[model samples]
Target: MTRIESKLQRLSQIEATLVDHPEGITRAELARRFNVHRSTILRNLADLTIPVYEEGDRIFIDRESYLINLRLNIHEIIFIHLAGRLMTSNIDRQNPHAASTLRKLSTAIQGLAPQISQFVKGSANTFDNGSKKQDPHYMQVLEVLTSGWARNQKIHLWYHSQETGPIKEYIFSPFFIEVGAFGQTIYVIGRLDPDGTYRTFKIDRVERIELLTEKYAIPEDFNPDDLLNNAWGIWFTNQEPVTIELHFSWRVAQRVKETLWHPTQRLILQEDGSIIWQGEIAEPREMVPWIRGWGADVEVLQPESLREEIKNETIRFMNLYGIFAGSKENEK
Candidate 1:
């Protein structure tokens, strides 16, 4: 086979393997599976023209393109286009920032979509929390997202998220939507367990957002209100609540007081002018450093247990690293 043809064939094989197993298949394993030397494997990687993520030695591919390439059947592509189009008008993808970001993305997914007719077939009305320009393409995404949300359905989405690592024959799934201040992002935040734990999968991060034909009925009692309310920041979870208390210096107290940390938070202003900020929390490990951002100006006053956890973590961090304070005594 010609050099280009060989790479194409091998790339197709890798795509098949991933289609069978979306979790991931490693590089060394890829070399072994194809009976190629490590060097040939490296060359194939370079010439394949597929994107992958590498953290140290582990390589992962999102499951997006798997089905698309597997079928190579026009009918399937047409179906994807039609289903994407049939989605109600309210479906929204995390609209990208108006910059080079969107430009790069629009360019990438150019050929990934099957056909325009599939999407535009069902007219999707467009409405949004932001400006309403009525972009036809954006309208398609909105329709798809809204359908996924309303039906409690899943979809295979094309997104860019942190988990996606190369071998891009593709993975796509539509499930939960990550809603943040800027807009909707390509992530599905849903329950991972019967006990009400949530795990989020990023849309673009994975190759495919395979919208399951099976519909999921959210238990009537599942209330995301508490879990969302207790978050320290964007990182959310359904973990148990921990009572965390923070003491703030007068200097930073006012600014901190004006904001709400959790819906359940209560503020007690001490006679000495210190503020005790107490709340039910989800994740303490992430919150400790934010508490320390005030330097010596803030203290963890309550939940003696959490104070100990913070103190131990602080000591461990200091021991593992070195720092230069502008202080003369420390310099000496």
Candidate 2:
């Protein structure tokens, strides 16, 4: 099996085993059960890539912590199983492993469906959380970042920024680490420049990484959190901080109050039923496309320069397909 195949299928089997045996299993038995070599089992647990472990000859699974850490519900577990299986079964699929895993996950509810459906009896409970440690390469990256703390020179990474095209390459130094979800978590906060600037890169979204042997000293006063704390998302560039005030109509007043748009956004309700949102941002231009998404539901109140920018954008959008103003055809 390929890496993707092994990753998901192994996790699915591990989950099923954890559900079956609460007390855990012997490393040798686990290897036999999976039909894989003992060395493979040893590598899986020792790798710490997917989250399995062993204590002495006996192995165990940390189910509670695993679920809590990843914030996965029962449905999600089932989904992962079904998906993994499908990927392995369907050779025609592009990412057959991914498809199989998803298929397994989709049918995971059925793993215990018989027990839940026409159950006139119950199975004795022997399931335990401490089974064995899983070794996944993705998890190893976290270990390297948190403890190893090794500055692996400069790395050329392929990253997706605008969310439109392919991941472009950039050379930067990774400094601080943020542990997030189960798989899609773990982001590196570092500076692209040697002068201690700030940048955040998601380890998962990173399509490629090549560490160079050339080492550059990280600035003495570098703080990635301080750099990212001021903005929202990972698009942090050194730009002039500007205040953006927006007026939201009462028609969608509940919308603004319901969701968080940015880290520094503050909402104040006015008597006219409209709400005023105030936020200090370093990149006003980045906010334009998003604010435009709200359309007439929002109106930029201050920073006339931004307003003009939006106006120009509005005109540009209107003319995209030769949209004529005040034309009956445009009314549609």
Candidate 3:
């Protein structure tokens, strides 16, 4: 390993050791454990960001200030394992920090939960193999955002908008980081500087980010859950909620009934085994792709505008495939 890489690894090890021994460990002991001099241990401790203190010759880290030390039961560990698996499967991008976190968790629980450790290790490997050629800047951008969020600081960033087809600069105060329900894509919700209008920016679209020293406070009324309460996905609006109704074919009725797709959703069963699903959503546009994913197994029954939009999209797809009304393909 390169010098910088080796130093970083050593620093991480020191932090982990400090967390494991919250009561305190002697500087001389840390130096002996890592086979380095006590001076080297002091330098590494200085580089650490966590709250570290010294009591005489022994070093200690504030467990309350450190977020890594967890006292989880077997069930909690299994739940975390499942969550790790889901994240590995859903996220298409490569995240080195995520892989490292899973690896560390796997190692930490290897003796207590051998089976789960293996699964978590497998998930970390998935990230490594899957992200060989992905975007290189994603991790760096995420790190800056995470730091800024944790410090309650503003960030100045250049954002590339797919819709606008241009790069724009914004000074933003990050209120929350959220993962979309449909794509599982990461987003940072915040207010634009000066104007202070709330906006959600996809992390992938962030071209450049610099954490600003200037800090900001989240509004007293700002609650991420409340902000996203009416959202179909990540797109919520100030307009009134639109009531959506969908009819599901009997073939997928049981599958549809297995989960509550939305908090406002209400389902009614028909005599023919078909199901009617209804919900109120702030932004219907985000649900379009999800609705289309069901193919012929579902139909949009209400909101004439949405129905028409879907109908038009279906017609376009039919035309693109050369499937005319009376064509053999359509008949099939």
**Top TM-score hit:** 3
For candidate 1, what is the TM-score?
0.44
Question: RMSD for each model, in Å, please?
Answer: 19.5, 14.2, 8.9
**Better candidate by lDDT, 2 or 3:** 3
Residue 319 of model 2, lDDT score? 95
Candidate 2 residues lying further than 4 Å off, grouped into runs, are 1-171, 177-188, 193-208, 212-223, 237-240, 328-332
Q: Which runs in model 1 stand beyond 4 Å of their true positions?
A: 1-146, 155-176, 180-187, 192-197, 202-204, 234-239, 302-332
TM-score of candidate 2 versus the correct structure, residues matched by position:
0.46
Worst 10 residues of 2 by lDDT: 120-129
Candidate with best lDDT: 3
The runs of at least 3 residues in candidate 3 whose Cα sits more than 4 Å from the true structure, single-residue gaps closed, are 1-67, 131-133
Per-model TM against the reference: 0.44, 0.46, 0.79
Error of 3 at 136 (Å): 2.3
lDDT string for model 1 (69-159, tens) is 2323445545544443333232354232322222332333447753443233222222222433434455355455556565555455544
Q: Which wins on TM-score, candidate 1 or candidate 3? A: 3
Write the residue-wise lDDT of candidate 2 on 1-332 in tens digits.
Answer: 89878866886776667556645688788788888888887766665443455667676665434542244456666454443333223221133223333444334444556443222111101011122223244444444343323534566667775457687877677776654222224578776744655667766566555666566556777766666654544445676667889999999899789988877889999999899999887767667767887887888887889988987887888899788899886787
lDDT of 3: 0.86
lDDT of 1 at 7: 75
